[model samples]
Target: MRNLEFKEKMHEYSIWRANLVQAIEMYQQWLTRYGMDDAHRTNTLLNILSSLKNDRITLAFVAEFSRGKTELINAMFFAESGVRLLPSSPGRTTMSPTEIFYDAEGGSYIRLLNIESRLEDMSLAEFKNIPERWTQLELNCDSPTQMQNAFKELIATKKVDRELADRLGLWNEREAATQGVMNPDTVEIPCWRHALISFPHPLLKEGLSIIDTPGLNALGTEPELTLNMLPSAQAIIFLLAADTGVTKSDLEIWMNHINRARSAKKQGLAVVMNKIDAMWDDLGGSNDYDRSIKSQIKASATILKIDEESIFPVSAKQALLAKIKSDKELLAKSRISALENYLSNDILRDKRNIMASIVMRDIGSLINESVNTANTALSHASEQLEEFRKVDFHNQDMTGKLMAETRDRQSLYMANVENFQSSRRVFIVQAKMLINSLAEERINEVIYAAKHDISKSLTTIGMKQNIRKLFDDLRDLLQDSVDITNETRRLVKAIHKKFKDEYGFKEIEPILFDIKKYQLELEEVFEEGEAFRTSAKVTMTEQGIVVDKLYSTLVAKAKVILGRAHDDAISWSNGALSPLARQIKDHKKQIEGRLQMLRKINESKGTVAENIAHLEAELVPLKRQREELAIMIKSMQLEGQLAESS
Candidate 1:
């Protein structure tokens, strides 16, 4: 017996199947005069039909440089050296965006994007030699051992020679020139700057894709990371070194890139107060110090307008090293335990909520549609079979005539049937694979790259100087905005007081109204200024990533293909297939017309599925951020109460 859920699902599927049948009939009539091959045309129709599937949720990590982003990734994903994605040093390991996903049969695959390759069937080591393009390739494997070997091979193949690195902007050419290196030979290496790895992980398999973006400045500089990737994220984890607290860059990031784009109803942001081990000695297990730290956290949250609970103070470096050495004792340490608990509980909870919402709304409908379309095609095939069997081919003495008619009818009917089955299989497989791939890719490309690059950029620029400059700029802006607000308030007050005195009015109603208006205007100006600051920061990040052109191009291509496929399917089914049968030929045209109407319905279903998938992916990060903000808001209220009590 079918369960209630299954029955309901089947009902929904039936509706879609009926709609699909009508579309097929219409497309056949439209294409009858064209004499196109039934097999090829039906294949095209199936591809269009498959678009009515749902997408999955993908989680990504984004933050500023050198805040232990990569260390956190290692702690979370690559505890074993053999499982690591990229070589983490004090400088950049990834210069481009990469994605990783899982393959069918529960194995892992690595897919590197934007790499130029000349050789077919290249090994992992050979990936390094490819030029950079927007193309991608896939590799298959499983287990930590396999992953480790693949990583090693990739690194070996793609290792940037010091001389080549300098020329390609990975290393400082000016510094090399100063060292008396003249006329060094340049190698023609592939422009492939990013690596993508796909792995089978429990969380990822469950429809979560984690993306780790580059450092703060890097994120800010990369427009694609923000406009294309970050906005699409379900949850964003912003990491700040605990010792530094929320630095100017962190503040800038929040105000500019994160805060505005976030949905308050959805948990969208979490601040990871990392490198807490550095503060361990200073804390000294003192209640006073703990209280002080908590107080400071609250104060910071209040100023930043963030939730305190979302601020997780952790030592990513210690956690990663502990995991790497497989030291159980170290892993059990309070700091490590705290971080782990938070991730498993608070983070996971938000992820679950987002997933549930998506499943109920988007994925559920898509699954139903896919099943229905398959059933509809099956029904049509059954009808065609019945018709073929009833035909009196035996009475026709001419074997050639009988054979030709049978072949033509069988070819057309079988083609549509085969195409439908193939499409259903491919859609289901690709959907699952895309989800798994995104998680592994993010860990390798964003997290690892940020870890190395942060340190390198800091060292190159002189950390103290750069930090000071960032702080000075932030402080000046904050002070200026505050000063302007205060001045405006004072001016409004003075005008009200003067007007009341001159008019000899005790109520001063008109003056009060004017003052209120001026205050509102002032508030608007302040809001605009805040928005401007955020936009400036986001713009910088966009410049760094160079994703604007890429995103636009991809989106455009997807739209065009999807549209053309849908239109072609409807035309072929309605115009080509309805004019053959003697008794039903006129009725066939009517059936063909029904197929056109069915096309519109199926197209709407496809659009709905796409929309739902996009929303589901977005909800995960948004919910997490919202939860973090809620915690900070509660902390701020508590602090206010304490200050009042005192």
Candidate 2:
């Protein structure tokens, strides 16, 4: 229902983000209208707006087969469909990792990637961009039956010979036999490796993305699920069957992927004890399963090493039935509203804070820079107006005196300009060295070396050794980057101090490039890589599958992060000295303009009153700009505070 608590909260969050984006857009227009935008600053602002426009609160659903992950999704967000949205039937319903969200461009569609794509070295991320690679099926959103039938494709499977299954690393003899489903002739594997569904659901339309992942075998084989998608989610809901408590496979998924994906403090993690209705005692009182649910919650917390507060016990099937039949009593018994409240309040609030931090990181410095430049210009304008007002127009000697003062100021500024040019040459040399070290060519060389070594390795153990060596090389690259970054910071700092001390420039600190954040990111990547390297699934997988998984997950992911660091370095070097340099240039121009104005009056071609009026006209806009800039900054601050407290 539109009045559902989760739906209402999601709507509120979307409106809040939309309003913030409007404020940001207005600021961009204000900068352009005032002729204050530079190439670098404008590009940065555009990038920030792009991030905001595409922002979504993503929650990943992770579990072993039949933990009711897809069923919970159906109850929580798609209950309005009045039937099961995703095919969450008995055993391995969602065979592949499926992402459900609204795509503005594609509208409504079911895009499935063929499982054969896993045979390639490309990652799921790369495959997403190549639309032709996906089998696009029309999704009739207006017809729930049609949509439900189409979703059955998510659970579609094809039988392949055991040899083919082994090559694909989907035939786990031990795992299959343990489940008593061993077959020598044929093995069933998902028809698709990944599915991307762009549906026009209301909550999804409000920038809510849901990832429904498969069982432990899939989690182990598909590194991207653990290494990329799971971590990127703002919240990860791990499902466990309440009737079975926490099984060995459930605990395996917890320890290896879900536990490793999050922090020790367990932020953004919710363990859902689904199928609580199965534990309901018909012979007992209304609160029959209350004690049973609480007992299992404590047991799950202890086994998973998370707080009991993080575990939610709910009946997805009952919740869906309640909503469909408009039965409030059943819904309460389902306890689905509690989980809905958590998603609405807790998860959405946390997501807002994360988004706020990103906005602050990207645009905060640029805003400060704009404010500083405007203040300095306004101050200069006031000084010019004061000097003109003090002039005695009838005293012709006054014009020559003003001209002489302007010339002296110009001489001092030009002296510093000459010194800046000489030091700039040295700065450019050091900057090149810093950027070249982070160049694509250099990054590729390391990647190529690692892949080549892995390809050459004859045995699985040798391949594992090669992967370890690659991480060492990657870490070494990061360390070298850190050293160069520090070197550049010292060089830039000395140059900044030079201009301030020698030229009487106002105190302004250069925004130095930060490599520590990137280092920390790479360190986490290394930890995950090591975990993957040592995982039994990876080591025991076929060599080709191992290579494919490594390329798509560990190697491809790191390369992307490193690529970002390089782009940031380029942006930093270009804009590092811009604020100070612009000020120097502006100061020189102002002095020259004043001298020209005085010469006109001294030559009897212009009146002192006319020049003073011209400066007065300029001051009006400058004053208005200052007011607007202050308002914009205050609005962002208030919005960020509200995000935290709300």
What C-alpha root-mean-square deviation, in Å, does candidate 2 show against the real structure? 2.9
lDDT at residue 446 of model 1 (Cα atoms): 36
Residue pairs that clash (backbone atoms under 3 angstroms), model 2? none
Kindly list the per-residue Cα lDDT of model 1 for residues 584-608, writing each as its tens digit. Answer: 2322332453344233333443553
Write down the worst ten-residue block by lDDT for model 1. Answer: 505-514
lDDT (tens digit, per residue) of candidate 2 on 552-610: 88788888889889999998888888777777777887788777767655666467677
Q: TM-score of the candidate numbered 1?
A: 0.42
Which portions of model 2 miss their true places by more than 4 Å?
1-3, 181-183, 458-461, 596-615, 634-646
Stretches of model 1 off by over 4 angstroms after superposition? 1-55, 80-86, 91-94, 105-109, 114-193, 260-266, 282-296, 321-329, 332-646
Displacement of residue 498 (Cα, Å) in model 1 is 66
What lDDT does the true structure give each of the candidates? 0.44, 0.84
